[model samples]
Target: MSASSTPAPQAEGQRRTRRRTLALCALPVVLLLVVALFAPLPYSLAQPGETANVLGRRDGKPVIAVEGAQAQGRDKGRLMSVTIAATQPEATVRLPDVVRSWFREDRAVMPREAVYPGGGDTKDAEKRISEEMKDSQHKAVTAALRQLHRSPKDIHVKLRLGDVGGPSAGLFFALGIVDKLDGDGAGGGLTGGRTVAGTGTIDADGKVGAVGGVPLKTQAARRDGATFFLLPKSQCGEASAELPSGLRLVPVGSLQGALDALKGIRTHGKVPSC
Candidate 1:
């Protein structure tokens, strides 16, 4: 038989193999694109269910003005806010500082095991919560704020969800609550509007948590004209390592603590206009 007439099994097999290889390579690429476009990964491991309440209220009503509904479906905009005319330091201290410290240091300190390395799937748990509960607390808080601002009900306490990686945001969150209560405008009439930048996580009891990526965040905040940068007391030393010479690292531990820290910054640690 002529060469052309013979069946080419080897050639056909090679072609099939090439097609399979291409498909396999394409799968991961497609998945990565989806993660990037639709749902990004969480910055920290403090998943959704671990802690439920994030807002605080005063006088039987929400003290902060939140726009939770607006934040819905917005991945990065997820945040919690509290409405209070004034921050009460005693409320936070009422809880054991040791308990607070445990949470503060848990992520970085937890040891990994064989079954669930890196603290028994703790990272995985946090990742799941961050993904499934995208901006949930932010929406809840915003809705509550709107309701209280309009109706003035007897709720008296509020909390909302917030992001993780960006601990510096705690400063902004704390200042927002303070401005809402003390500022001339409704909810303090403070218009941060990307003017001032901050980092650190705020506890319901009003303590700030240490955050990673201090240098990058601080540089970004400074570039945006943030006069003050809020940092967790634990992370303060770490943050100093990355702080730009001109940037201010306002060390804080809790929401109430942040307010206290801010007073010190406003009085003593004022940064020169950039």
Candidate 2:
């Protein structure tokens, strides 16, 4: 209205113009940050993966079956083997995904090389994993036979699972074989009608070996309704990092140890734990 009032409104308009300009000037920087956040990194994101019951059927067939032996418990309670769903070595991982996964208790971020040892050649990585899976299966059969004091040449065991590859299934593979053959040694199923899960590598000597990504596998087990986990004694600490509710860890270092623990669980006897 007055000249003074006119100057005040003019100044206010100028201030608004400057603020808008500043925001416009900062837009590129914000966009750059967003782009960087979404850009690919050399890491892999992982979470709970698939679970298979060793003592049960998949696709209408036995997961673990033994020939030329008095097999038992093919329909017994579940012996679940857990896996992780991880970004493959060939897949792209973003920074923002990594940052968010870092704070998540149920998730994991892994070095791409760790998931695939040679890194860039995804085909080679997959081949290696497949080879490891085959080797683990062979070793599991040998270990199970040895545990039962049976000769490998005289016995035949078959293991099958679709598209899953890793040595981590060795422990469960062996257990499943043992369950089908011997069970709990008292005419009872090894799992005692309870759902159990685990992951570990195994040697022909029956020694259980550590498999990385225990936390993720543990989560997978819990998600698949497993109440007991057969843990490699060495992975006790890792499995405890984000243990799920109602899941129990049974620490085992050998096939015999795992059998004993399962027996204890079935009979409500004392069992060693992590």
Candidate 3:
């Protein structure tokens, strides 16, 4: 072959080497695309969700209706419960979704195992949530009655919650009950005409316990126009770090402490801070 017509050996080798290098570089891109599209991530996305007023009506019925005692009028303030959305076990989460969640301030990325332990199914998660809700409601009612020094037999308390399940509403539920019972008494209502939002697990003894999703809950409370938020004392640090502007965070270790704080709000007294 003529030297001009034939490709040089070194040039051919160089062309092949360039092609190999391009292929090697493209391999990772192709693999990443595939994984991003199809592979399930080990983490789940959590985001801030809706807030509901415990004292408000739902489905044409009062959320917290009292029978036997004089039903108090609605307070000017609101007691809200915040919720967070978490990925279910059966749902598949991709890397792109996780990456998106990481950039969103209201969204949280958590390990799948941490969200759904023991590979539990969706039904199991629902059942667990329902149990927590029921327990919280019971505790809240009991605590409120105890704090008011009222007998459960003399008053009937019915909680009407629609499709909401979580223990984080316990504190607000207790507050709502107390406000309903007190109704502008000497100490004034628990809310005292200011939007109050809170999240915590309450026991029968009125002790407040920490719950998860404090940061998201704080954001939700602030978005809902809550002037004050009550959180378990143990979660004060998390709440303080993410405290929204124009919202006051009060850390309470017990139900009485929450009441005292609210009274302070109403009376313009010095209130406890987180």
- Specify the highest-TM-score model's number: 2
- What does the lDDT read for residue 252 in candidate 3? 94
TM-score of each: 0.40, 0.85, 0.84
List model 2 lDDT by residue over 172-262, tens digit each. Answer: 9999898888887767788888898998899999999998789988889988899999989988998987899999999999988988998
Q: After superposing candidate 2, which stretches have Cα over 4 Å from the reference?
A: 1-39
Q: Which regions of candidate 1 fall more than 4 Å away from where they truly are?
A: 1-171, 184-195, 267-274
Q: Order the candidates by lDDT, highest first — what do you get?
A: 2, 3, 1
Clash count for candidate 3 is 0
Q: After superposition, how far is residue 67 of candidate 2 from its true place, in Å?
A: 1.3
Q: Candidate 2 or 3, higher TM-score? A: 2
lDDT of each: 0.41, 0.87, 0.84
Badly placed stretches (over 4 Å) of model 3 are: 1-38, 72-74, 116-118
1-274 per-residue lDDT for model 3 (tens digits): 6555788999999999999999999999999899778798777788777888887888889889988898554477777888878878788888778878778888988887766655678898788788889999999999999998999999999997888887878888888898888854764566778888888999999999988888888898889899888889898888887678998988899889988888898778979888
- CA lDDT for candidate 3: 0.84
Query: Which window of ten consecutive residues has the lowest lDDT sum in model 3?
Result: 183-192
**lDDT of prediction 2:** 0.87
Instruction: State how far residue 155 of model 2 sits from its true place (Å).
Output: 1.3
